[model samples]
Target: MEHMEQYSITIDGRTLTAWEGQTIMEAAHDAGIYVPHLCYLRGLVPFGSCRVCTVKADGRFVSACTQPVTPKMTIENDSEELLDLRRSLIEMLFVEGNHFCMFCEKSGNCELQAIAYRLGISAPRHDYQFPERRLDASHPDIFLDMNRCILCARCVRASRDLDGKGCFDFVGRGRGRRIAVNAEARLSDTVVDVTDEAIDVCPVGAILKKRVGFKVPIGRRTYDLEPIGSDLEARRRPRAAAPTGGAS
Candidate 1:
């Protein structure tokens, strides 16, 4: 295999190296630069559905998860305009769904909630839809709460690509769109299991494992100690060098 040439691009005035054919999100993540996103998992194909990873590059706003990084490209991610856009998007997600993080099991571990905290969104700026949604607890080991779904399709892709089960999919168009199991009758009739990757990749509290609610305790969950981008920022720090020339 031929070695891909590496080049550098400037993001927020910081020069970061990236390889050819790599998307801006991929390059940024590999360089340990945090770019807030949903509907984009590391190993999964970029869906670009959420539009939360939007960043301005050379005066044009583009989805960082899908746009390829080019040499000499100047990307702007921390500007006030971008921050406001992100906040508005987060707020929209809040109102579109019945998050109710206070009572949800995935509250502390939810990426959506963490992103909301990171963007300083104390409340939804938009009107709440309060759509009447349903919950499916037919499965013995897993359940689905349609109310909390952001329709990011993480589970859809995970089930299709990773699990090879094609157990889940989106049914309906536009306002009526939603995640549906293959059986369509009930979750208990499907082949999905508790160990499926789809059960774990949900950004919101839509899909969850059963019988383990509140196991970690409140205020002691994944994002309770640190915000979403904290780990990415920590990854950006330089590591200590290993001792050389064997034991002295």
Candidate 2:
């Protein structure tokens, strides 16, 4: 493959080299810089709906997941204003649904919950919409709890792109928009398998596998033990090589 162009960009005052074709979030992650995001799963195409990854690119705010980095671009990711805005977006997601983590099956292992913790959000500031969603346990091995869905579309993208099964897609418009099964009213009427990527890619408890509930204990679940993106933070800004044997 032709070499991807590389150039420097500054995020939150830190300088990091970024490759061409990489979005702001991608470049930040490559440098072990944690840019909070949901609805932007790696491997799948970036869907900038969530807006949690919004950052200022050269003083113009844009969704980092979709905004490609440019040479010498100044991106403001962790500014107080940006953090406050991100927190608001996340809070809205929480309130838009009935996300009762204490009662939800995906509580501890949920990416949405994990991100809330990572961002230090104890509770949402926005009022709950509680849009009167319902459950769809029609599938023999899967549970579709619409109440917890933040509409991140990770399931939609994963099913379409990763599993090669377009079993999930959005239907309706605006507030009425919701996930729909392929050519079916319910999941049981669709072709979704229990092991499908769409089922596994749900960031929240919206789409969950059944029959193995509570398999992960309360205190030992992923994100329960560590903040999300801990792996990337562990490698934060891979140290510049030791200067090749103590200075030239």
Candidate 3:
């Protein structure tokens, strides 16, 4: 059997070696370049819904989380075109979703909110197309706010990969799209365990812990104290090494 290729590539003008099959965002993180992202959950398949981590490679806009690293490829991490696209995506996320920062419990700590601030997005330029959504707080600890969801599908992927339970899936397409529980059951009724890991996997306040809803003041929240990427990187533990004699 042929092995998956591995190669060295350059990102943000920095050269690094990585497996060819690994996504560019994974390679960037390994190199400490800190490309922004929202829908990418580690150990899960890339959903490419958030579009905050779009980068220019070979003169095209592609999601870094889904784009595979090519040997000797040149990646522009913060090019003008890429940054503009990112800003536009962030703005769209702000307006498309029911992200009322002033009233949100994750006002300061949200990944979506932090990336917007990081990119100098003062406020959304377009009109707020507010859509009415029901909040599913029936669960004992997990809160599923459909209005705030960007439909990033991190929760869906996490349910399948890390949790070994495919409880969540995308329900619709395009504008009416949403992440829904399997068989249309409420999240509280799913067979899967709603651990903090699932909550942490969410990039926005769509899913949160009921216990800590109002515990931290908005002024003292996470991103208010540290950058979003910094907090995420801190959570990055080392991957386990491969076995030495693995039938190579």
Candidate 4:
């Protein structure tokens, strides 16, 4: 692999080095900082749909996933204001989509749920939208439940970019937006396979394999083990304190 140039950037109070063209989130991740995000997966291109990764860069708020870092850039993450904003956004998602998380299959494994837990969002402050949604179980091996969908575009990007099949896409506009398969009306008409990345990439219970009764017992799932971003936080190699001059 070619060596990319690196430089320094400040987050909160600490300074760290980052790749030349990496997004702010990427740089922060490399430095063991966990910026909460939903639409920014590691491998696929960074989609800034979910603004939960918002940060203050040089005093201007920006999405860390899409905002590329610059030399000497100073970023504000985990501030009280930013935390409240993220918490509010998460709460809105919960109420807008009727995310009855307690009964949802993706409760523990869902990124939305995990992020909400990490942000200490016990309940949303907004009124529930209760938008009516559809559910499709026409496929023999897959199920589509729009109720759990956050419209993060992970499935759309995965299907088109990684799987090389433009099976999943968005239809409608504004609050009427939804995931639409290339099929005539249902996923059974599309060429989506059980093993496709699109099926596996859904961060919520929206897209799931059929006939696989929840095998993983509760209390052992992904977020159940730890709060979201704990893995990256663990990856951080603690910086040793600077040496005191002559023991003062």
Candidate 5:
């Protein structure tokens, strides 16, 4: 078999090697560089709905999650301009929905909250749009709270692509957009299970598993001990030597 050619790109002055077909975000993650994102899951298709991953590549701003890397390409991810853009996006999400992270079950483990914290967004700059969204608790083991949704479509993609069940989809348009189950009836009538990838793919508290709220307790959840990008930082760090013999 012939070997595929590997090339390098310069991201924020750091040269990193990348494969031919890999996107900028994928290459950055593989190189232990954290690029903030909401809709770009590792296995799922890059939805690029959330513009949080926007970065300047070769002086052109583009969604890093969907933009492929080219050799010697100049990608600026950590620039002040890009960081401000990400912060603004996070802030917009906060105001667009009723994301009361303090009272939500997915607070600490929520990707939206984690990203907001990472971007230093203490509050939304824009006025809150506390739209009157509905909550569907008819499901036996799950709850769908539209108020907290960011419309990232992670659930929609996961349901259609991974679950083999087109149970979820985006309905309406613009400010009226929402996720709708195929049943068109109550959520209990739908075929979605608690174990569905769609449930796991939700970035916020919009879709939650019932009867397990506060199970881990506050200040002890996923992002409690460390920030969202801490894992990437750890991966970038050099590993210490292992002792040849048993512990002293």
Candidate 6:
């Protein structure tokens, strides 16, 4: 396929050009506009459920990842209206489930945590729905905690696309919906390969290394990188591991 040419786009009255076929977020990132995002990963397809990256393009608040650019498209990435919308979305994420970042192992290194900080959401404005969930520490290398999962599906995609192992899937719907390993089976027994890619693909600490916990401090953590794309690309490196035991 031919390389797509750069096209002009006006976001927040600033006109800039970006390569065709790149998502709105990619274009904005190239133009030095940081769109608040949580579910977006560099090497995977954009799943916009987190809604923090919504931008007002052509008078509609659409996800920058799912929405492609068009000629003469004007977007408002940081207007007061969209900022309020983003704040509300971040608040929803905080109250939807157990996102206790302060206690999470991936607090400083988490995308959701970073976006929540960027949105200035000090605390959840809505009621907290702390549902009961079981933690899966059966895997020798990693721990799968349902409590911190926001159903971003980045790990699922990483398993399928990058690792060639479709190990993760969303089981149930709405409040009942959670990422399950191996068609509702245990993570240790899943036929899919659980490489370092699977672990790093997670936006939160839902899937974490078993032995290594909080080795890096908050301020010196990986999220300190200016553009998240470079960090994400670096994390996608697949590390060699011994044969994993049965799925948990």
Candidate lDDT values, in order? 0.84, 0.83, 0.76, 0.85, 0.85, 0.74
Provide the lowest-lDDT 10-residue window in model 5: 239-248
lDDT of 3 by residue, 1-248 (tens): 34655566777776676664678887777655778888876666777877888888877788888888778888988777777888888899888878888878877878888998888889888888898877887678788898888888888877777787887888777787878877566777877565635567887888888778678775687788777678546654343122111111
TM-score of each: 0.93, 0.93, 0.85, 0.93, 0.93, 0.86
lDDT of 4 by residue, 1-248 (tens): 44455667899978987776778887788778999998878777778998999999999999998888888999999899999999998888888786877777777899999998899888789998898999999999999999988889999999999999989999999989988999889899999999999999998889989876467889888988889999998978544122111100
Which portions of model 1 show Cα errors greater than 4 Å?
237-248
What stretches of model 5 exceed 4 Å from their correct place? 1-3, 237-248
Count clashes in each candidate, considering only residues at least 3 apart in sequence or on different chains: 0, 0, 0, 0, 0, 9
Model 2 lDDT tens row, 1-248: 54566768888888877877778887888788888888988778888999999999998989988888789999998888988898888898989888888878788888888888888899788788878998989989999989998889998999888889889899999989988888747889888899888887888899988877888888898887789889878987653321111100
lDDT, model 1: 0.84
Candidate 3 segments exceeding 4 Å error: 1-6, 183-185, 217-220, 231-248
Q: Please give the lDDT score for candidate 4.
A: 0.85
Pitting candidate 2 against candidate 4, the one with the higher lDDT is: 4
Quote model 3's TM-score.
0.85
Candidate 4 total steric clashes: 0
Model 3 clash pairs?
Answer: none
Residues 167-236, model 1: lDDT tens digits: 8898999889988889958888989999999999998889989988999987899999999978878877
Clashes of 3: 0
RMSD of 5: 6.5
Error of 1 at 104 (Å): 0.5
